[model samples]
Target: MKEFTFELPTKIYFGTNMTEDVLQKESAQFAGNVLIVTSGRSLITYGYLPKLISIIEHLPGNEKVVVYDKITQNPKLKEAQEAISLGKKEHVQSVVGFGGGSSIDAAKAVAAGIASDENIETFLLNGREPDGNVLPIIAIPTTAGTGSELSKGAILSSPAHHIKAGIRGKKLLPRMAVIDTSYTWTVPERITCETGFDVLAHAVESYVAVKSNAFSEMFSEKAIRIVGENLPKLIRNPGDHAAREQMCFASMIMGSNLANIGTCLPHRIQYAIGACTESSHAAGLIALYPSWIRHEFEVNPRKLNHVFQWLGYDPVNDAAQAEQLFSELKTEWKIPYSLSELGIRESMIEDLADQVTGNLANDRLSEKESIIRSILKESYLFRQ
Candidate 1:
């Protein structure tokens, strides 16, 4: 065991149909005006927005609730800026992220922006660290992936600059997280697959990351087991409430692991792919997994074996077997297994590799650009 420090400041409420009670109990955090940040009108279309607003309005000390529904997929810096502007104008005291990871990430960024009165672009692009003066945030996740609800980081993209990266700080951790499985019941099948795979990615990456410790590994292993078991069930029957609950649980715990140890090369590289193309985050990760896992086998076969065993592959020393199983899983779930499938081009590989930010230290890989280019090229043409 290695020496490490861990902290999870967010109070988590996990279950089905407990959002109201949880909000009522934690209403002090929602005192004064509240801002609700979402990706779009899906919450409104699903009738969740009105219900959430009504609940917040009824909470003790809650004065008003405003909705900022312009958050977009991949959550750009401009969206955070706009939401922060609205929050400031409305005098919102706290923010509630009311959808998937994108909304939750945007909400955190908005809270930080409002509190500091600083443009979030400085943090995302200029390497400015967020001071611990962020407005209180409460995350209400309607998806079972990204685990952004309990995380201490927010991923925002700057399309204008062609850069996507994370803004990380302890202050960015939500003050509270509400995970109601019932809210995830209506997620479309395609999203379900993508986000569920994201859960697996978080677990696997954290478990294998060089920064991982005993505490983080415990949560990572549990999340991996839960994802392997329940993701398949949800794929077969999207309405499996029990499976949904399990996945939500897995997602929540994996979030803690991510906060503690973080992910590996794939997440770092995926940022470049995201910056260059309009690929879903998880799709890029899935495409990069084979090369990543192969690297793990070469550098740390023992750790890779532990991860595969958790996913129910016994005696899995062979990297090819592991890659084959992953390919099969992607095919069954209809997830693309190649970067080209997500519209990434062979010609763009060099630039994509150049756009990659951060170090691969956590992956135990060389930080050389050629290593990264090789991985990208392999994933571009990957086929099982």
Candidate 2:
């Protein structure tokens, strides 16, 4: 019912075998050499990176080239600093992020560091604003979640700070997004489902966010349908291109949805879970979602109920809806229903709750600690 405006500037290339051409299109925005940023060694093994290099090398007037494949899960400040040093040393004109969320996020951090005079560590910790122009970044996502390919946010871990924080701004958004579903073929079935849950969570958060608008809802609505219908199917049959394409399409739409509306409880909570427990972000979300949403259920049950509706269930109430969504996802993927089984502790609850609420400056975070603890308790007890 509230009015809002939205803007998404990244040019998206969707379909099979379009990753190469999308990079070429994005290349027009930059001149000279480019930094090739990647993660998980997938580029080197699956022949994805070599093929990309072939295309980039064929282009005329492309001179400077560097490869920074030192990215790791929960990409760190040291990595960004190294990347910046390499970027400055190489004087690259652009960066191509080739991999999943970590790689794309590292690409954003690399761009942020390359564009600025200050250290990115301070920015990532305390949420500093970018004041300089960033080099063009072309994102080619090999996974379907986190939406980092199109998001302006990057999360980095710093041992010095002993915390995980995010650097966010439109400047960090990729100049172009190459989201070819064909590339997702190499993704493991478990990751496909976990990341799929992240996309599903993205749409749900975007739909009910305080900043939601008509346009954001439109994107989320379709995204929820696409992901709800396709995620489990993809898990069942990871090679199905149609389902993969639908998941990719939904991922992008969810990106747009979050751009305008932003995310709240579940995403913020998942951040703490990942920072502390090192649980897979999406899987943590899958564990915490039912509990996290319960705190906000009375706020808008019907809106959240739509998630179940789209997932082919009738949610008679909050409990039923949560069970239906989680149960179905777990059943399809054979995912366990407990956080402890995934290596989370009950003792982490108090601290995690503190961080989840402390991390935000918004009014909603002012609730009593019990409410926060209760959420984590539910997450601990959640099972299909």
Output the number of the lDDT-best candidate.
1
Q: List the residue pairs that clash in candidate 2.
A: 33-64
Cα lDDT, all candidates: 0.87, 0.76
lDDT of 2 by residue, 1-384 (tens): 665778889988888887666656655654688888887486688988888777887666777568898888678789888989999998888988888888888898898789788888778877886668888888888888878877888877776665767888888888888888888888888788888888888988777776777888888888888887887787778788889888888888787766556787777766777776566667777887766666556666777677668867777575556555665566666565566665778887788777763233221432545665776787786555
Please estimate how well model 2 matches the true structure, expressed as its whole-model Cα lDDT. Answer: 0.76
Off by over 4 Å in 2: 318-321, 357-369
Q: Judging by TM-score against the true structure, name the best candidate.
A: 1
lDDT of 1 by residue, 221-281 (tens): 8998998889889888999999999999999998888788888888999998887677788
Q: What would the TM-scores of all predictions be?
A: 0.97, 0.93
Task: Kindly provide the TM-score of model 1 when superposed on the true structure, using C-alpha atoms.
Answer: 0.97
* After superposition, candidate 1 runs with Cα above 4 Å error: 367-369
As a whole number from 0 to 100, the lDDT of residue 255 in candidate 1 is 87
